[model samples]
Target: MLFSESIRIAVTALLSNKLRSILTMLGIIIGVGAVIVMISIGMGVRQNVTNSIASLGSNMIIVTPGSTNQGGVRSAAGSSQKLKLDDADAIKKKIKNIDYVAPTVNSSYQIVNGNMNWNSSVYGVTPEYLNIRDLTVSSGSFVTQSDLNSRNRVAVIGTTVATNLFDAANPVGKNIRINNQPYKVIGVLESKGQSSMGTDQDDMVLIPLTTAQERLLGITYIKSINIQVSSADKIDMVQQQIEELLRQRHHLVGDKEDDFTVRNLTSLMETMTSTTTMLTLFLGSIAAISLLVGGIGIMNIMMVSVTERTREIGIRKALGATFRNIMMQFLIESIVIGVIGGLLGIACGISISLIISKFTQFNTVLTAAPTIISFAFSVGIGLFFGIYPARKAARLDPIEALRYE
Candidate 1:
């Protein structure tokens, strides 16, 4: 028979058993859909985390005061001593890679103006802090060096803070009391979207670090330092230099541990990427298990099909159909089942992945590659399941098959 005739026969056979074909393909559809959905979610999560890190500025290094310990092991950075304002100046002057270093002090207080008192966090830092964080002032200038030197009680406030506190009033030059200490509003930072750290960027206040330290918090100890590296390539070298500088300044012996730790930009990105990829693979693998089960379902159905068509196979063979022709007929039937299932699986998978993307926090993005890959696998599953049944049919003795009522 012509190859086209064989295909037509195979298709006709499967169409006659619609319910069985659909049921057999069900596994493949669900498996492929789930794989796409889960993997897309994973990719989205990675993108979200990376964006969050990028928002903080890749060239920036955050120096926290306390050592973060894991289990019972204690790890420290530059100095065991509290980070101070003096350290910021030392880093700026000593380290060549360091473009600018700013010290920060934080306070939570009730800010009041014109019957509008909003309770929020207030940070005190130098003018350079705005540039380093890529923050902008819309209406007024940032608190200047003169402001820090004179210990002026001027402040820069966020948009939300401005709305809540000043309302329609021009906030610049207006005084607001923070922690019962009066401060002059010098500038307002344009709204920065919420950080990955979950802090609303537009809900805080900024002041000169010296003023905040001496007047409000009443503590000279700085909480953290923000260091800016001049170039991306210089991060590792600069980190090493900063670590060494801190170690020597803190009087650490050659064999002794340093109190400070220096972190780099790429490390943060790498950590986030690896973490996201692993989670995606883990989820995708779990989802792929269902595909295997679906394959088995296809195989079971094909076996049943072979048995049901025993008489027909015998009749064909007796009518001068060769063994190879019979085998091809059965094999084509199986491949058709697989190809159909694979196509349907791809469609179902894309729909599910898109639904997940629309409703979830993940940046679930679907690519053609995974779709094509998964569809191809579905076809493979059909052949894999169809093989045994086809072999059994081909090997059947025509007399015996004809006798199988």
Candidate 2:
């Protein structure tokens, strides 16, 4: 029989048992859909992480106080008071290829504007903080040098803080009390959304370093310093220079550990992206197992089909059908089932990904590569699993098959 005839015969046979064919294809459909959905979710998570890190701005580096060792008990990073305003100033004055350096002292305070009160993160920083963070004032202006120089009681609020404090009214030029120490609101920052670590980036307030130290936190030491390098290539070099400078300033000997840590945000982005990619692969692998199960189902159903059609196979062989023709018929049936399942699975997977992204916090990205790969793999699965049953049908003795039942 011709190959086209074999396909016609195979399709006819599947159509004759429509319910069974549909049932057999169910596994493949579910397996393909699951794999696509899982991969899309993984890719989405990776993308979200990358975007969040990129949102921190280009060539950003953070310097925080390092651990302290006392009686062999070491403290966490930022436990020491080594990161100070002087460190930030020195970095700005001495470091080459540096754009901005902003020393920050962090504390939490209850902010009050008449009857409305909200607790927010208070950051004591200089005018350079806005530049280092890539933040802009939507209205009014950011903290000025004069504000820092004279320790003026002025504050800049983030979008979240602004909305919570003043509702729809403009917050700039208004006075809001910070820890009951009245401060003038100088500016409102644009929305920054959330950080990679899930912290609300737009729920804080900015104030002058001197004012925070003198009035609120009552500390001369800063929590961290934000540094923006001029170019991406200069991040490592600048980080090394900052470490060396801090070491010299802090008077660290050869054996003594430094009292500060410098973090490269670019390096962090690479690490996190790599991690998420691996996780995506792992999830894809797990989902692929379902394809194997689906293939096994196809094999099992094909075997049963071969047995039920043994007399038909015998009749075909007796009428001059070649063993290759007989095998091709069953093989085509299996491939058809797989191809149909794969196509349906693609639709289901994409739909599921869309639903997940729309309804949940999980980010989902559906791309062509995974869908194509899954479909191709499903076709391969059909070819691999169909072989044994097709060969069995082809190898049967015509006389014995006819005489059996």
Candidate 3:
């Protein structure tokens, strides 16, 4: 028989038992949809992370005090006061690719302005901190070098702090008391909603580093140093140069660990992206198990079909239908079922991803790769699982099949 005739017969068989065909495709539908949703969410998270990090600054690097081992107990990074203002100054002066270096000291205090009182984070930093952090002053001016030199009690408030303390009024030139020390508000920073870690980025206050050290915290050491390199391609070279410079300055010998840690955002981003990709693959694998189960359903139904059509197979064989023709008919039927299921699954998966994105906080991104892979895989499953049943049908002896009741 011709291939067209076989396909017509296969499609007719499926159309006659529409409900059973639909039921058999259920596994593929669910599996494909689940995989798409899972992968979309994973990709979305990775993209969000990348965007958040990029928004901080271009080619940014951070230096913090390293861990210290004391009596077999290791302290966390930044627990030591080894990172000082001198260290930040040295990096700024020595590093070749460095654009801006801002030493930071942080404290949490209750801020009061007239009748309003709000608790917020206070960061002590230099004028370069604004450029390093990609922050802009919406009103007034940032803390100047003169402020640091004179130890002036001046402050720059983030949007959240401004709103909480001054309401609709302009916060510039207002006095806000931090830890009972009155500091004049010099600027209000532009709003930055939140960081990738979910921390409120616009809830802090900025002041001169000297003021924070001498007047507020009474500590000479800084929390961390934020550095922006001139270009991303030169970050590795700059990081290495900074490390060696710090090691020499700290007087570290052979095999002796340095007192500070230097980290580049590029490496951090790559690590995070790899972790998320692995998670996406794992989720996709788990969802594929259902597709396998669906393939088994198709095979089982085909086996039962062979048994029901035993006498019909005998008649066709006796009428000169070749074994290849018999096999092709069954195989085409399974493939048809798979193709239809795959199309429906793609539609269902896209709709589900969109719905989840709209209704929840999760970000979902639907791309063409997953959809194409899923559809192709579903069809391949049909061919793989259909083989055994098709071969069994084709191998039936005409005389024995005709004897069945």
Residues 1-405 of candidate 1 have per-residue lDDT tens digits of: 788998999999988989988888788888888888888777777877887878767587776554535366675543344567776778889889777787788868999885789998999899888878889998888988999899998999999899898776779988999987788898888988677545587998999999998888888778778888888888888878777777777787777754555666578889879999999899889988988899898778878888898999888888888878887887788788778877787888787777776775445778777777777887888788778888888888899889988
- Work out the TM-score per prediction: 0.90, 0.96, 0.93
User: After best superposition, candidate 3 residue 313: deviation in angstroms?
Assistant: 2.5
Predictions: Cα RMSD each: 2.8, 1.6, 2.0
Model 1 scores a C-alpha lDDT of 0.81
What do the candidate models score in CA lDDT, each in turn? 0.81, 0.90, 0.89
2 versus 3: better lDDT goes to: 2
Worst 10 residues of 1 by lDDT: 75-84
Off by over 4 Å in 1: 68-81, 166-170, 195-199
lDDT of 2 by residue, 1-405 (tens): 777887888889889999999888888999899999999989998998998888767899989996767678888988898788888899999999998888888888899999999999999998888877789889988888898889999999999989988999999889999988899998999987887546899999999998998888888899888899999998999999999999999999798887888889999999999999999999999999999999999999999999999899899899988888888999999999899989998999999999998898777999999999999999999989999999999999999888768
Q: Of 1 and 3, which scores higher on lDDT?
A: 3
- Counting only residues 3 or more apart in sequence or on different chains, how many pairs clash (N, Cα, C under 3 Å) in candidate 1? 8
- What TM-score does candidate 3 reach? 0.93
- Output the number of the lDDT-best candidate: 2
lDDT of 3 by residue, 154-216 (tens): 999999999999999998988999999999998998888877656789999999999999999
Model 3 weakest lDDT span, ten residues long = 66-75
